[model samples]
Target: MNKCIFFFLSLYLLCFQSFAQTSSVKTVPNADLVYEKTKLGEQVNSPYYEGQPVVSADGKFLFVYRVGHPDNVGYKTYKKDEDIWVGERMADGSFSTMRNVGAPLNTATNNAVLGISGDGNTLFLYDQYNLSADYAVTNIAVSERTTDGWGKPQSIKIKGFRWVSEPAYMNMSVDKRILLISYANNRVTFGKQDLYVSFLEADGTFSEPLNLGKDINTAGIEASPFLAADNVTLYFSTDGRAGYGNLDVFVTKRLDDTWQKWSEPLNLGAKVNTPFWDCEFSMTAKGDVAYFTSGGQNYGENADVYQVKIKEVARPEPVAMIYGKVLNKNTNEPIATKISYTNIKTHQNAGLASSNPKDGTYKIYLPKDKAYSFFAEKDGFFAIKENIDLTGLKTYTEIERNIYLVPIETGVAIELSHLYFMQSQPTLLPSSEDELEQLFDILQKYPTMQIEIAGHTDGVGNKQKNQMLSVQRANAVKDYLVKKGITAERIKTVGYGGSRPIASNEKEETRKLNRRVEFKVLSK
Candidate 1:
């Protein structure tokens, strides 16, 4: 009896240890999963084919390509109906009726909607604006949102580029830092339709295709690579790996900064994979639900967009989707602009998003475990800046922050936006100095402008102390400007303790808003 008990005890310990280890690493769904197959409802699908789906980062819109649809802008026959379509996600987790995204995107030549930037303001489409005689998928083109509508599709200059195999699929990372592509019938190859990656160059062009190597590329084929919001986990379709059928979807985690190193690919299992051709996998920023395309065993028959709930173990690392709009502070109207996110720690730009030229709305993905600073810039207005620390975020989060750029003129006052300091003291935190330097630069630009630094505090502390603290904070800001070579007399300081509040101080959440430093232009 004692020996049996000891054996069981030892076995239990081993099993527990193994479970803990495997749980830390993302696991692929097994073949046995009764995958709750996804559907787009009757509103979006027809008797024809629809593939190559790109879900917006917010998961509210979906872009895809269809074949043999009479409504296609260039529809001649089932083989010739290669036009892009757009649809909105319904409340029930399916799509509403899809319609032709229309001109500029749809032309006489055939193409597909390959990718959409995280901001939902740019579309990476199939084939260049000018297609070859045969309409072969050659390169990628981009179309950006304009005040009128989507502008003309412009081809991206991938150094040393050429043609690619049909259904040539691609995807962009959340930060737009890297672009993943799958192609064949070209210069370098491990096999047919091998996967490749192109790093975004400093000049806004993509580097030459860098093959993912033999571990990922096999002699068979690989295509439709989608990098998740985390930018480390990847989902792709290939016939090279061992799977149920001709083309199956697989998931792998990147092992290092060098794009070549990756974990062993795992089949997403029988549920998501069919013996038929399956490709174009994507997910929302949350990564809990997924969207892809699968062709039934029949040729292009039953080809439609798919959506399914993702297993927890298969989900990528969590990320924060920060979004909102840039508006004119005085008029309260949206403005077209470029929003840039930076790593506050290193003070290096991490990525950029262009707000819709018409609406001024924008969105960006910030990976967990770091501090970030972002701003929106317009020529005639002073840029509003903000800093966010995401180090403690362990799950997917959505943060909405708006920027109101004040016009640089007399009577205009804007909060410093990112001042930090120790509790109960006026000493500016190291993190806050960069913003002060920005102020100095503005002063240098407009040599004759005079400004007033105003300090504020929450209503929680002692009233007298709060007043004193606010005054000291204002003086601290003035001293920094004075030491930076600005004349001391050109600046004025004031403190509005708990008395004047932008928000009610009844709650801690709103109270924090009251504790801020703002500068008003005394003269310009």
Candidate 2:
């Protein structure tokens, strides 16, 4: 009778704890639940003790905090409050032998599983904080893994907020410009706890904390927020709504350009949640497998880590490519120069690369759907900056761009022909602006071209004075080109004090024709 009762209880627990292997939701028809838990073995026994699992952006490896002793420790000193182990799961679903990540990643001190970085190199853990057990400080620490092993654990201090029990999670935006961190604010414990986000600077420093506001945050406790690789979708744990128990995992997606217009949170449903604590859930970039913490039923003691198949959802893919070129202005010659791309929205630097001198072309791979700023620079030329606001265009789109460089000459004589300026005024006429606009457009279309901006005079006034005026007039033309988004470095201006004339300066009509500004394509 006793054996039968034990058997019945075991079966009931197994049936209730079983992970769903498939999802009928077609939001992500192409993706299926790819990883699942197995019975722990000597290495990783059945119903493997797993929790706080994080997969790489490519779904290649898994990082998790596991606890157990396989090396015959006599079970006496192998207490449940022992060391936290870090395990790596390979593509074959076989986890590398659970290795103590060691101090500072895993200290002799008790640590709670927190979060993992997008690159899978950084890990966040907090000191155990159960007041009843005498562990009550909210100690937060982060460890970075070098090529060798994990580095020393460094603690992060949050100002004005005490009891920083939960370090929450951090991730990249769709464009990878900004780093979003979600943490439970114990600042006001009585009111529902709040979640805050802080930006990561180019130098790896975090900016001032910004409250996510009351929209996504509620007066109820909110914690364990995980940012999807796309950066726009956020998953967090809250007790505001009904679940299997006290806390359930809910997700909120960034809705509009407005920072606060987040969509309402959606419950992950009953199967994944139990009438017990289910929080700190995490998902990979592929949105396939999910990991969380649970204590009741099958899990031996305390909060043990749990894994299950998440319904494949339509999440954004942040990997993509962008390409273009740089060139000379005068002869349309391709100039080999350096160019840099920056993700303004996410604050990510794509690094600097050179355009091919032979063909004046370049290509850059972007993590799709991120806005960027492209800047090109060369000696003796004005730097050019182009702002690309790729709000939602993350597909494999090919962008073709070019740049022009001006000459170094002081002055060159040229016939205006029909190049008419506002009579005697340096202001270019509407028709003249149109002509220059067309030339600028061509330069943009073909990035390897170079050109010279020349000014001429009809010798009607003081030669010296006319020369200076013509120079100014040519500079005005250059400024106009700059306003049209052309690189000023690609436009060299010079005035010929009526020194050289294509048309005879004998008649007012000929002199009128002599006074003008013209561009010559030096290379194509």
Candidate 3:
């Protein structure tokens, strides 16, 4: 009777344990689940250690850090140098033959690819070399994608970096405004390594780095931070937090506009984490697939890049992606041009990107829910302006806007899209500064260029009153330019009133278009 009782108790305990395990498995968030794991084939992974995979925003290119190659520039050294290799996605979904990113970026010393910009026009590299037998140094450098491959690299120096901490890895926001860096050995660190962020100030300098705080950083090391294209989700690796094994990848999200606050870190779960080291995770802009480095048995003894279909992953802020080419209006040939965008309501610089001279193609990321004024400018071309309003966006969107810049010649009129004023009043709004500055730049670029600033009012008031208001608005623009140091003689102001309407006055939208400001190049 005693033996039977003991056996029955053991059976009950086993059943209970099984049920608990099943329930726990069911409780995992769908986003934390992965549908499949695929080991990238020889085109990407070799016997050599390949890690730190980053895919292009368009998902057409893959960049990875590779070690132990016979063709390595550091082959003679006792410690082989690591370099970046890139592969193009093939038609069948496999990658093409991997090619070394090559020199200027890779030298006889250790060099690693840190991150690529969302537009795929910039490459960030970590360069470390022995300055002398007694000491070594590591620094981050940037290489711009030019018509003829990557241009020469330039070292990036952050002002006011604490001397004690060493930077591990870095990633930038989709808009290229905020930079996230992992630093080790700083006195303010919450763990062996912690994530810090720096913002691109209006003056074009990086702000002092600030810690991400205790919610994200742990008492153990946290490294390999990757900020998603949405700009809010961050994926990083930590051995400090409770996890399945060494340096498992985890994700957290920015809770608010402040970079310091974050949601609690969530482990990627058993499907993604393993007993061995798993780190250096990155995902596509859409967040459907995740690429990470692992040393699990399935990937062999050495670290290799593996990808999985993540059931759920944190998404970036809702954004509208703009991509297209800038071409010569007449020749239809691609032209390299500078693109600038301004937030119409806040009068803030949204961001800037340049079209690739080689292909004339360019891409930019814009935060949604704001009206924007986009301008494309080049030295000899009359600048063009485009207005976009994304105030009601509910999901990510892509816009194709190919710009054609006309050569600066007499009679070329470029409308000022950003100029605004108080309702029915002649006073210019502060948001007009961006367009005013742009006009200032054009005038400065062509010292002798003469332009006529014209203002028109919608057909909503008395003709005489409308004419007076239009003239005042035009003079207001002229005053701004003169205040900025342009000679008053170079600018002439005029008012068309409601006589010269560009669109019909039947609808408010058309009337808004009719009420406009424009500059016509008179002489250059």
Best by TM-score: 3
For candidate 2, write residues 1-524 as lDDT tens digits. 99999999999876665432112211212322423422223333323454555555434444555555442122245543344564567667656666655555544344444555433445555643222354545334666555466666676543343443433554333232344445555453323566666554555444555667666677576766777655577877766654445666677777765456787776666555556666666665556566677654332234656666644344434433345557656677777666666665554465444555456565543545556666556654443445566667544344566655454333432223334566656777654433454456766865666677778777777888888878877887788878988877776777776886768878877666677677666655
> Which lDDT tens digits does candidate 1 get at residues 393-468?
8789999999778788778678888889788899999888768977888888888888999999998979999999
How much is 84 displaced in model 2, in angstroms?
Answer: 5.0
Runs in model 2 deviating more than 4 A are: 1-50, 67-84, 112-114, 124-142, 155-157, 164-192, 201-204, 256-259, 295-306, 310-341, 344-368, 373-524
Model 1 misplacement above 4 A? 1-31, 76-79, 131-139, 164-167, 185-188, 296-302, 356-359, 411-413, 419-430, 433-524
Q: Compute the lDDT for candidate 2.
A: 0.56
> What TM-score, over all chains together, does every model reach?
0.77, 0.51, 0.84
C-alpha RMSD for every candidate: 9.9, 12.7, 5.3
Task: Go through the candidates in order and give each one's C-alpha lDDT.
Answer: 0.80, 0.56, 0.77
Q: Count the backbone clashes (under 3 Å) in each candidate.
A: 0, 44, 3
- How would you encode candidate 3's per-residue C-alpha lDDT over 1-524 as one tens digit per residue? 99999999999998877456434432125644454678889999987888788887767889987777877777668355678789998899888989998877777776777777767887767645323344333345678888778877776655565333333677765566677788774557888788888877766666778889988988887888988876778889887766666677787788887777897787777777777878878777766677888875422237788887754433555677888888877778998767877787776777767778688898877766788877678888765667789998767788999877777778877778668899898888886777688789889999999999998998987999999999999999999889989999999999999998888999997889988888899998
lDDT computed for candidate 1: 0.80
Report the candidate with higher lDDT, 2 versus 3: 3
